[model samples]
Target chain A: MGGVITGVDLLATAVFAVSGALAAAEERNDILGFILFGTITGIGGGTLRDLLLGADSVFWLYQNEYLWVCLGASLATWFLAPQFNSLQKLLLWADAVGMALFSVLGAVKAIQLGAPAVVAIGMGVMSATFGSLIRDTFLNRTPVLLAPEIYVTAAMVGAVSYTLLAFFEVVEAIALPLAILFGFGLRACAIIFDLRLPKYGDGR
Target chain B: MGGVITGVDLLATAVFAVSGALAAAEERNDILGFILFGTITGIGGGTLRDLLLGADSVFWLYQNEYLWVCLGASLATWFLAPQFNSLQKLLLWADAVGMALFSVLGAVKAIQLGAPAVVAIGMGVMSATFGSLIRDTFLNRTPVLLAPEIYVTAAMVGAVSYTLLAFFEVVEAIALPLAILFGFGLRACAIIFDLRLPKYGDGR
Candidate 1:
């Protein structure tokens, strides 16, 4: 179980790092910018969650593998972005998987830490989305959280489902996969159908 | 001495909150946006510092007063912004003071936690400037840190000086005020003289 979770975590981090590198490329930033963007995007969400939960040590400070993955993903993106016309589509699917897993994992951590269910759910959503938020912010773009997209909503649903399942004493192996699938399915539907939340005041 | 530090901390938080509210106003955000911006700006930097230092509890989490101050400042700005033509200038001065004090205080916290001097100085700079960076990101504006302005340079100088002073066994009373004054003086000069860092590539 631990091995599976760690694998998913690294995959998520790598996917997010690639997205960040792409953003840096779009902005014509140098290699330093690509690394900076990639590192933050890979780690920012979990870092924020750890800080909020008062973890003993931030996850990446001790485990250097995460940093290496981010760096590798960034360099790969920088060198290969020009040839990858379908990269955006690939990224969207990978991001959906990442978001699903992160939301469940974040909520699980918060629950273990004795955070209230609501706060745990909030942490889950934050963990699933904050990396992208930080990435977009640093790129001087409006964050996806502020958009009417179904992104955070998908994470929220996953988090809420996991918290409820845990409250019912559901087994970890079953609950984790179920919750992630639920979130990813929702996100996939949103992507395929171009679904969005209602805008403010009849689309103004 | 503790009371004095607490007072300065609250004042800095309030000042930063007001700056955030003003930013919300500039963007024509509603009252909720004002509160969100204000609260994050007031607490973001300290939160980041505490997380990095592995503090047992985030400062604002234990003290409800900080949240109140942020809320009050946001409400005040929402109501009073329309009538204040000089609010921008007032905010600039207040932000300078806040930045100066935060840089010193953040370094003090890091040193007390036994962080290495270089990391302590980094914490100080992060504590002073991250709130504004978060705000600018949310506002979709180029962060002040990314600009050619001398904003971060002032904070860096203040943090470095404080760390160095502490290393030399300077007393808190003398070291604190002097570091802040040096930082604030430099910021004031930048504001007055339109000082800027050299842009990339000899002005393109």
Candidate 2:
């Protein structure tokens, strides 16, 4: 179970790293900026999650693979961003995948760490959203979480679904995939359909 | 020693919470936003410091006093913002004091947690600045840390000062006041004189 989850986590990290690199490219930052943004975006969410959960050490500090993955993806994007058309949409979809995976993974970890159900869900949403939040803040842009989007909602659904499934005695193998699908499906739909939640003053 | 340090910590938290409330008032956000911003800004730095140092839990979560202090300050600000002309400058000085105290305290805690000197210094800077980082991020403004100020430099100097003093067997009674004075003094001078570090692209 750990092996499977670790594989998914790395994939998510890579996707978010690419998104971060692309954001840096859009800002016309140099190689150092690319690496910094990528690494932060890749690991920022999990780092916050681990910290909030009182983990002994951050995941990347304990194991170097996450750092390497972020750097590798950053370097790759530094060379590829100029040639890529439609970078924005690509970033959105990739970010959606990362968000889905991280949300479920964070919730699982929090539950294992003895967090209450609601706290686990909140951690899940935070883990899914905070990396992008950091990236956007660094770029001096409004974070996607602050925007009215299906992003955080998808993470909540993923977390809640996984928690409910676990409560029903479902195996990890079955629960993880279903939760990922539920979150990814919602986020993908949002991207495809330009879905948005109503603004507070919109009178909808 | 612990008693004195805790007093300084709570004072800083109250000051920062007021600043946070003022920031929310500037944005015309409602009561909920004021409370949320106040609470996060008040404790955000120490939370980051503990996480970076791999502490068991955040300070506010371990003890409830910090939360209450933040809440009290926020509530006060909610009722007082309109009549409190000149909030901006007041926030600046209060925040300067906060930066000073948190920087030294964070460094001390990191060293006590067995981190090396350089890492401790970095944590010190993080603890001083990250609360404002969070506040500015939420409010969609660039953070002071990235604004080419003498702010982070002051925090660094304080951390280094305290660490060296402790290394030389200086008692906390002597060291803590000196460190805080060092940081706060530098920051106050910067604010008074409109001091700034040389910008990267200034071509000077």
Candidate 3:
């Protein structure tokens, strides 16, 4: 079970790194910028979660594998930018999968640390979204969080469902996959239909 | 000495909160945005420092006073925007002082935790500048760190000097004030003379 979870985590990190590298490529940043953006986006969300939870050490400080994965993903994207142009839909699906996994895993970690359910859910959403937020912010682009999209809402759904399942004593193997699928399903629907949440003052 | 440090920390938090509120005002954000911006900016840097150091609890989590100070500062800025318009120079000076103090104090905290000198200096610079970086990023504005100004350099000077001084066994009473003044002097000069670092590709 732990092995499965770790695998998912690394895969998620790699996918996020690819997204970040693509963003840097779009900005015409140098190779150094690509690596920096990739590494930061890969590690940013988990770093924030661990810190807020007062973990003994940030996950990447002790485990170098994540860093290598990020670097590899970044270099691949940098050298193959043209190829990625045709993989946009595939990238979006991968991102959705990553977000779903991160949201559930983040909540599980927070719950293990004895955080309240609400705080755990918040951590989950943060863990799923903060890397992109950091990447966009550093690039001087408006963050996706500020957009009227169903992104964070999907993460929240995963978190809330997982927390509730845990509270009800559901086994991890069962609950984790269910929550991830639920979250990914919502995100996939949003992507397929170009769905958006209602904006503030939309009633007027 | 402890009391003095605490006072300075609170004052810096308040000053940074005011800056964040003013930024929100400039963006025409509502009152909720004002409070959220102020609170996040006030707490962001120190929280990052504490998390990086693996502190048992983040500084603001155990201390509610910081939150109140941010709230007060934000409300004051919101209601007195007109008054602040004429006090831009004063605000800049205050911000400079806050940056200088935070840089030294952040390094001191890292040193006390037995962090390496280089890491200590990095922490100091992070503590001084990250809040503003976060504020600018959330508001979709280019961060001042990228503006070729002497902003972060000033913080680095303070951190590096303080670390060097501490290594030479200088007493806190002297080292703290001297480092703060050194950093503030550099920033003040930059502000007064419109100094800038040479930009990449500027020679061409």
Q: List per-candidate RMSD values in Å.
A: 6.6, 6.4, 6.7
Assess every candidate by TM-score.
Answer: 0.61, 0.62, 0.61
In candidate 1 the C-alpha lDDT for residue A168 amounts to: 99
Weakest 10 consecutive residues, lDDT, candidate 2 chain B?
A: B27-36
The digit string of per-residue lDDT tens for model 2 on B63-127 reads: 66887798789888877766667767777777888889889988888888888888888888888
Candidate order by decreasing DockQ: 2, 1, 3
* Stronger candidate by lDDT (2 vs 3): 2
DockQ of the two-chain complex in candidate 2 = 0.17
Sort the predicted structures by lDDT, highest score first. 2, 1, 3
**Which candidate gets the maximum TM-score versus the true structure?**
2
TM-score (second chain) of model 3: 0.92
How well is each residue in B1-204 modelled by candidate 3, as lDDT tens digits? 777777878888998888777766666555545665776777777888887787896766446678779879988877776555444465466567768878988998899889999999999999998888887778786666665558999999999989999999998889888988888888889888888888778989
Candidate 1 Cα deviation (angstroms), residue B58: 5.4
Candidates 1 and 3 compared: the better one by lDDT is 1
- Candidate 1 per-residue lDDT, tens place, B1-204, comes to 678778878888998898887776666565645666787788788888877777786776546688779889988987777777765576677678778888888898888888899888898898999888888778786675675558888998899989999999988788888998898888889889889988779757
Query: What lDDT, from 0 to 1, does candidate 3 have?
Result: 0.79
